[model samples]
Target: MLNLSSHHLQTIQAHAESTYPEECCGLLLGHLSSDTKMLIEVLPTENSWDGEMVDVLQVVDDSSEGKFSKRNRFSIAPQVMLKAQKNARDRNLNIIGIYHSHTDHPAIPSEFDRAIAWMEYSYIIVSVRQGSACDLKSWTLDDNHQFQPEEILTVSL
Candidate 1:
């Protein structure tokens, strides 16, 4: 199970709302104990799919011709993730999971999500409808490389 404070959930919802029509992505920093992953902080990251860099790439790469849009895709740069990992280690925490928002879509992992997910890391997805966050769900990749639903335990500060 994944345990997070109410405030953290609110923050994630707010971020999802603010990035309406586009997907928002971030890292969840926390420590693990037995079967629970306790979330300590949320580190927001820029979605590369929404940036100008991708636009430039599409012009040069034929394979990326029709892809690279934020409405259905979100990507975090490797350097950003590395930095977050190092920072988490410095604070005695680990990047236990990643979170993203699906605008106007259900909070469930897609086929692409399943293909990209790493084993043992929680994947939290928030569903934003009409610029408001509606449903939220957590998932983890199983040994068969498929997404399995995970429980979310919200705690109060």
Candidate 2:
């Protein structure tokens, strides 16, 4: 289960809505208990998916011929990941999860998301319907690399 304040959820929703056609991405900094993750901060980021770099995403096939955009793809740069790690370490928080938005789609994990997923990290996805945020969901990768629905506990501040 993932525990986060309503404010955190709102921030995610707002980011999704504001980005509209383009998808938004970000990191979740928090503490992890036995089976629960408590969010401490929601760090929104720019969508830096250049669509030319399939190598980073471990795409062995040349399926993508550089025809993608922020509307359908999102990527956090390695430098951003390293910097986020350092910030979390300094604040004694772990990067418990990552979050992104799916424009005009359900808040469900896509094939691409599953392919790039890492273990022990929650993934939050928000669906933006005609520029309106809706249907937020969280997921975690299982032993078989399948995405399992994660329970979200919205707590009051």
Candidate 3:
């Protein structure tokens, strides 16, 4: 099971709403050192498939254009991945989880999400509807690359 605060969920939703058509994605960087719990930091980042570590980039689209290119692809930018990795390393934190928003679908993990997910980490999905946020769910990849529902608990920040 994964544990996260409502505030963190809100932040992710806001990002999704802000991104609109294209899809908003990021990394949940922090540590759950003890079995009990720990605070998870929400680091908003761009989608980059260049490398393993995702780096965080500055928000450039402040305007409400809501325009998604024809590609309709979502991923963390290479630079963003690098930055996120550095940030995690400096804080001695592991890549405990990942976050992404579904523009028209529910918070459940889609088939593609399940296919591309890294089995070692938790996947957080936020669903946005008509520019409004609706639901949130987390999933874990099982042995067969299938999505297994996971529980989210509140964490102290």
Q: What TM-score fits each model?
A: 0.88, 0.93, 0.76
The residue-by-residue lDDT of candidate 3 on 16-123, one tens digit each, is 888875578888877754342233688877654332221221132323233333123367665777788898889887777778888777888755566567866788
List runs of model 1 lying over 4 Å from the truth.
50-68
Among the numbered candidates, top TM-score falls to 2
Superposition TM-score, candidate 3 onto the true structure: 0.76
RMSD of 3: 7.8
| Predicted candidate 1 versus true structure: per-residue lDDT over 1-157, tens digit per residue | 9999988898889989999899999999999776789999999899876557566545444455566578777888889999999999999999999999998999998776786788778899999999999999999987899899999998864
The CA-based lDDT of model 1 is what?
Answer: 0.87
TM-score: the better of candidates 1 and 2: 2
- Listed per candidate, the RMSD to the true structure in angstroms reads 3.6, 1.7, 7.8
Ranking by TM-score: 2, 1, 3
Reference-based lDDT, residue 54, model 3: 18
How accurate locally, in lDDT, is each candidate? Answer: 0.87, 0.90, 0.69
